[model samples]
Target: MTQERVAMIRERLQQALPVQHLDVEDESHLHVGHAGAKDGGGHFRVLVVSDAFDGLAPLKRHRLVYDAMGDAMRRDTIHALSIRALTPAEYERETA
Candidate 1:
């Protein structure tokens, strides 16, 4: 179940963005007793690097990710999502 969500998220992001790098992690175990977990929703963190986010504000970047996530967010398959959406240049600077 955990891995399935990760795969689904990664695939969805990849399809929506021209990602240079992507990492999706399941953090559900850390929030095992959290309220959302009871609803079968999972907590996740995603690092998305793409030129698509260039020049966009952080809020907009997140919006794009949420939009890409689509029904997953609305349907409660993803209860919480921590996103680090960045352009390729931002990624380079962060790694540097």
Candidate 2:
């Protein structure tokens, strides 16, 4: 997908999830010459901080984001996503 589409997706996710911090990085350059890039989709890294992730296991948090991405993954609009989800408390502790 185009960068605009990726940005839009990220924006929608941040709005819906109301995260304290969100970073969406496109890793398309790393995937250049790979088979998936032929379709214009690419890899991504998502870092998110939210109270909603409190009490959730790491796998559950990742699952929540994958579910939110929905058809984008299935259709190869997003080839791969690396997610780092943190609750507000966790984020503060890490930064401290």
Candidate 3:
């Protein structure tokens, strides 16, 4: 189920953005017993590198990610998302 959810998230982001690099990690286990966890939604962290975020501010970048996620958020497929949205240059600089 986790793998399927991750694939779904990756697919949605790829379809909505020009994704150069993407990684999705399931962290649902970290939130065991939490209120939101009771609903069976998973917690995830994503690192997305794309030219689409070139000049966008952090908030805008997050918004783009959220928009890409679409109904997964509302439908409880994704309860919490920790996003790291960046351009290729930013990703390189950070990794370096």
Best by TM-score: 3
lDDT of each: 0.93, 0.82, 0.96
Ranking by lDDT: 3, 1, 2
Q: What is the lDDT of residue 74 in candidate 2?
A: 74
Residues 31-96 of candidate 1 have per-residue lDDT tens digits of 988999889899999999999998899999999999999999977699999999999988999999
Could you tell me how far off, in angstroms, the CA of residue 30 lies in candidate 3 after the best superposition?
Answer: 0.4
After superposition, the stretches of candidate 3 with alpha carbons farther than 4 Å from their true spots are none
On the 0 to 100 scale, the lDDT of residue 64 in model 3 is 96
C-alpha TM-score for every candidate: 0.96, 0.86, 0.97
What residue runs in model 1 are displaced by over 4 Å at the alpha carbon?
A: none
In angstroms, give how far residue 69 of model 1 lies from its true place.
Answer: 0.6
Model 1, poorest ten-residue lDDT window?
Answer: 1-10
Give the better candidate number (2 or 3) by lDDT: 3
Candidate 3, backbone clash total? 0
Q: Which lDDT tens digits does candidate 2 get at residues 1-96?
A: 467757866876776676898888888899898998887677888888988799999998988788778787877578888899999999899999
Off by over 4 Å in 2: none
- Clash count, candidate 1: 0
